[model samples]
Target: MLPLKGLSVFDFSTLLPGPLASLILAEAGADVVKIERPSSGDEMRTYHPRVGENSANFVMLNRGKRSLCADLKQPEVVERVRALLERADVLIEQFRPGVMDRLGLGFEAIHAINPRLVYCSISGWGQTGPKASVAGHDLNYLAETGILGLSAGADGAPVLPPVLAADIAGGAFPAVMNIMFALRERDRTGKGTRLDISMADNLFTFHYWSIGSGTSGGGWPKPGAELVTGGSPRYHVYKTADSRYLAAAPVEERFWQRFCQIIGLPQELRDPEVDKKAAIAEVQRRIAERTAAYWCDVFAGQDVCCSIVTTLEEAMDDPHVIARGLFDHRVKSGSVALPALPVPVAPVFRSVAEVRAAPGLGDSNQELLGTI
Candidate 1:
């Protein structure tokens, strides 16, 4: 049986963070029911680049889950939801701090109904901080937490992240991990607990090395100037003749020696005591003399830890990725079917089904609310 086969989750979250947490639970066999608003439902359903019926974003993040639409302002609807919470194993929400309390569905209220429910609240800040009620997004959270200031572009400005690290890494992954911890605690104490997951607060963990460096009197890291950031010649990106980028990270002494040999660098330039700027410039010049494909062929059999940066499409179709079965599971809507979003859950814990459909808005309202 799946690990969470009998667990029940009521997810009152929209967009990226909370929904994604619940999605991981559902992937591990929890019966997750999304509680959305009445007509418009979650804003993600209307996002750009539509697929079968809803936005592809919604379909990918919410596959294999049921949806129940209810107007929380209605007393009858609130009562029905409370009845369902009495038997739920997990509850996830992402509204501003007091919004759930105003709706009478907060952690304390739900804990009273079912003491074993793992109640999780995800927000940009946190539940009781000075900025708890303030509005923010992924970029704002990264900027506020000093993560965005560390990576600077050639223009000397902090480069915007390509993905939602705060939402997925900070908010969603931490919520899921803590919910599992809370569940284990409930098994020991026979009582559940509240989880306050702050996206901005959790971002500090990603910079542990930088934090230790500053605290240990080794000087704080400057923008684009750390060993793993763009400061070292052994761990930096170089441009090839066709303008494609090669991500090179032969940091170890052995790999660095091999990389120098493969690139045919001069003996003097191979020494670390030589001017780093000169070494980096020479490497860039040599790489620029050849195309990315030429470098790919040259480094194919070697283990110098380098790769030509591939596009998203190319990565998706890579033979090694396909062999690993990352995209084997499919999400379906009407006749349109695409690979499901691969969560970090291992294959042995996920469902055996190959295909599952994302629910339409309010698809479970009658089936779930009528009984409740």
Candidate 2:
């Protein structure tokens, strides 16, 4: 049986962070119901790249979930939602601190209704911080947390991250982990607790090495100057003659020796202790003299710990990825179907792969709230 088959989640959150957390729960067999605003519903529904009747962004993140539209401002609707919360296993919200309290759905109120409800509030800063009321997004959170300052380009400026690191890593991941912890605690105490998940706060975990280095009087990390942030020749990206890049990570002594031999480095430059700058220059020159394909073939079976950078499309079609059945599940809507967004849930915990579709706005209102 699915692990969370009997769990019910009322997710009053839109967009990436909260939706993604509930999506993981839903995929693990929780009956997640998105409590969206009436009329427009989730703003993600109108995002670009349209699918059957919803945006691909919305469909991918919201698949296997139901939607219940209700205006919390309305007294009747608020009462109906309270009834549902009384029996819900979890509740997720993304509004600013006081918004839920003003709407009468805050943790104190809901905990009174259902002491077993795991209440999770996701925000950029947190519930009681000075910036709690300040509006911010993923980029703002990362920038404020110093994560954005660690990776600067040749121009000495922080480059924009390719993905929403704050949302997925900081917010969604922590929410899932804490929710599971809260569930386990609930099992023991027969009571649930409130989770304060601040995206910016959680981001500090990623800077463990940097934090320790700075606090230990080893000096703070400078952009592009850290070992893992493009400072070291052993762990950096090099451009090939064909303009493709090779992500090389031969950090260990053994791997570095193998990498030096594979790249045909001079005997004197092989030892990084001699002159780090000279070794980097020689490695760059040699890597730039050959095409990415040539290097790929040369390093195919070697333990050099390097790979030619591949595009998203190329990665999706990789033989290893296909063999792993990462895209075996399908997200379907009538005649339209697409690969399910790969989640980190274990296959053993998830049900068999099957076609599923994100629900239309308020699609389950009648079924879930008709009695109320």
**All candidates' lDDT scores?**
0.93, 0.91
Q: What is the lDDT of candidate 2?
A: 0.91
| lDDT for each residue of candidate 2 in 225-305, tens digit (9 for 90 to 100) | 778988788988999999999999999999999999888888898776777767787899999999999999999989879
> Model 1 — which ten-residue stretch has the worst lDDT?
223-232
Q: Estimate each model's TM-score.
A: 0.98, 0.98
| Per-residue alpha-carbon lDDT of candidate 1 for residues 136-248, written as tens digits (9 for 90 to 100) | 99999999888889988989999999999999999999999999999999999999999999999999999999999999999999886778778788999999999999999
TM-score of 1: 0.98
Worst 10 contiguous positions by lDDT, candidate 2 = 270-279
Model 2, residue 171: distance off in Å is 0.7
Q: Which ranges of candidate 2 are over 4 A from the true structure?
A: none
Clash total of candidate 1: 0
Candidate 1: pairs in clash:
none
